[model samples]
Target: MRIYVLSRQKLLLGLLFLFTVGGILAITQFTLTTPSLVRTPGTYYMANTPEKVVALTFDDGPDPIDTPDILDILKEKEVRATFFVLGKAAQSNPDLLKRLVKEGHEIGNHGFNHDYQQRHLVKEMNQTDQAVYAATGYHTYFYRPPGGFVSKTQLETTNRNGHVVALWSVDSKDWRNPGVKQIVDNVVKNVFPGSIILMHDGGYQRSQTVKSLGPIIDALRARGYRLATLSELKTLDSETK
Candidate 1:
């Protein structure tokens, strides 16, 4: 009977040891992968300044039709905005992508595909970064999930990669073909100093966005707001390690 009891205790102790080891491994893995918590929103920082500086960012772009028009407007205005280009679109429109680079505007990785709920965001991000790097020979440190849906892991991965996840403080919803007047009014009403305004130069039916661009720029400039890219608006200095 004593032998049996000892054997049972030994089994229980072994199980306990295994469980403890597994728990430790899990915790260690999490610690190793989890991004630093210093910046909560992970990637993009909304400018906290009271200065009349706003970022104008376009997503899912370099579309053949709308992008060129938008670029023309930007050039005419002599203002720059961040373009978050999808890998597939960038693959299809290499010249547009190059044009964006030549125009002194900043480019951000919008993923290989526009997957807002991409389960493999980190994996896709690595691939996307590589693809963009290969194409432009320019390394980008900015990312935005499709539709702006991001998980904690996605945020952590981006932050670890020294990339900022750009989010919009104001959306014109030109994607929905909102009236030009409405798009204009929306910006006039919603934009504030340090606002990251969202518009799109790609995706479906962006003609409305193209149409709205001129007036939006005119109105904003008239109001004395300087529209700049995400990089220009948000000052990201190199961390002294």
Candidate 2:
């Protein structure tokens, strides 16, 4: 099981190889390097820290069904997470956005659409920011580019807009509808201190994702890991620096 999960991890890392030479790209600092708590300005992957903590983050969400179910699970477990929401979804579900903030979970911008190769980067960021602000009156502090694809231009725009580019170290791959147990192992086995675990709440059926939440939270807690929102993790990164 460990080998299988490790292979999946390797594959995801390759898919997310990230970064560029000159024009701007993602740095591969998310690859579990200890004592390398280096902070790349305007961007974040896994924080370089040794605290027994990890952030639970969801992307492409604010789905009325799956998101609420995920929220219910989170609420029942008394765990707070960070949610990356689409602009259109947030516009459609203002109440959900308010609920997330009211419930103490942090919200992030996922873009106006899920165009992983979107061309209108600035527009997408603006629209999502507007939708979030309209719904909750909170400007998003974090932004995850579509499909974790960041360009130099996007980074500059995000910085100008005062948003941090967020990435993940551990991917649940729940979008593949991989079994609940596999999803659990994908996250549980890959996490290190200050790891950011990515899962999805919207964009699909996501029942497996909803189901895996309890076990993922339970396993991490049992292993003496404290789950946190990405904001908290970033704050820790700053204080330690």
Candidate 3:
């Protein structure tokens, strides 16, 4: 009887452990997927405005092949975007970084080497900031955590460094290489007023991203949405308030 009782207690303990783990995972998923819930004082996923303005942001870039093409498309469309470029990439492709600044695109730090560890947050950000400034002579006020995996401590460190943590409301998922149509549909269907759309210009083969760019721009414009840089979108949001 004692052995039977002990076995039952062990089963209860095992179930309790499973429940705790599941609850933690559920919270993490919610925080990652729901921009509004996760946004803290220094983070912005979407602008709180009724204006027909949206921000388009690119991450992990300044790619030698794909970035130039993406820039050309943006120029042709008369659209300005914010690029959250990695430090190493910015250092290696300084000319591309300069071109980005010269063409009036905003630059943000994506960390030095894409390190997402809490302990390395400050160093990664500072290194990226230095690289961007050295290349473009422009200071960036925005920082995007690698993979959107930000801890509270990391967010606090970022804010302490005078950077706004930028997240996205509409994710194009172009990084997945899901296909050009799927990428376009994801942006067009999900974007709303003051939405910040996430796309990638580097970190992998981004030919599809470049191809989908024109269509995404045209569709959004047709929907009466104006694409703005991250800073401009913030201004619009503030003005409406």
Candidate 4:
């Protein structure tokens, strides 16, 4: 009995030791030992400003049907946004690209082919710039990677090309087709001062985005938020700093 009691106490102590060690390792590995990644220079996730303004950015577009409807809504609301154009899409729909430029909206390079690896980021960026320039005689100064994914090479190339990397703070997730009301709520609820809203005008069937656009604008306006382009947001960011 004495031996059995000693054995049981030893087992309990052993288990306690194992649990404590495991907990320490888990915390250290995931928390203190892990480093927070530094955002590369010349890249912006969202503009920093206290003003009641936001930038609406659309990605993967120049879609013929939906892009026009989005533009029409923007025009009706007298609000401007930034369209991050895919090189292939821009090449295929130069007229839409032209319309984007002519309508006082801003354009940004979204990369060619929507390549995920972005191994040749600089080339992709230049090709996108060329496609837009060919259509509208305009040069884009902002770069947002396909799928909003960022890589060190992409950021370096954007910096090398003297363009700013624009990423979004508030994602509409309209690409998910999560219903128009859900999309609007996703954006409206997440938005902050100088927020850059991520939406879609192309890359896939974006009908839901089309429907959510006007309501998002009206809701934002009702919330006393002034919509602006990426460039305008950048200007506001500068003033606050």
Query: Evaluated with lDDT, which candidate comes out highest?
Result: 3
lDDT of 1 by residue, 1-241 (tens): 3554458889999999999999999988775443221234555636777789888889887789889999999999898889988888887888887788889888988888787577777677777777667767797788887877667887787788767787777778777787998988877898888888888888787878888898998999899998888877776322211
Tens-digit lDDT string for candidate 3 (1-241): 3554458889999999999999999998887765534555557888888889999999999899999999999999999999999999998999999999888899998988887564688888888889998987888899998887777788887899889889888889998899999999999998899999999999999999999999999999999999999989998776436
Candidate 4 lDDT, tens digit per residue, 1-241? 3554458889999999999999999987665322222234556867778899999999998899899999999999999999999999999999998888889999998988898678788898999999999999999899887765676676776788878887777888887799999999999998899888889998889989999999999999999999998888888886445
The candidate, 1 or 2, that scores higher on TM-score is 2
lDDT values for all models: 0.79, 0.86, 0.89, 0.86
Q: After superposition, how far is residue 229 of candidate 4 from its true place, in Å?
A: 0.7
The clash tally of candidate 2 reads 3
Candidate 4 overall Cα lDDT vs. reference? 0.86
**Which scores higher on lDDT, 1 or 4?**
4
Clashing pairs in model 3, backbone N/Cα/C closer than 3 A: none
Worst 10 residues of 3 by lDDT: 33-42
What ranges in model 4 sit over 4 Å off? 1-42, 239-241
Off by over 4 Å in 3: 1-41, 239-241
Greater lDDT among 1 and 2 belongs to 2
Could you tell me the lDDT of residue 225 within candidate 3? Answer: 95
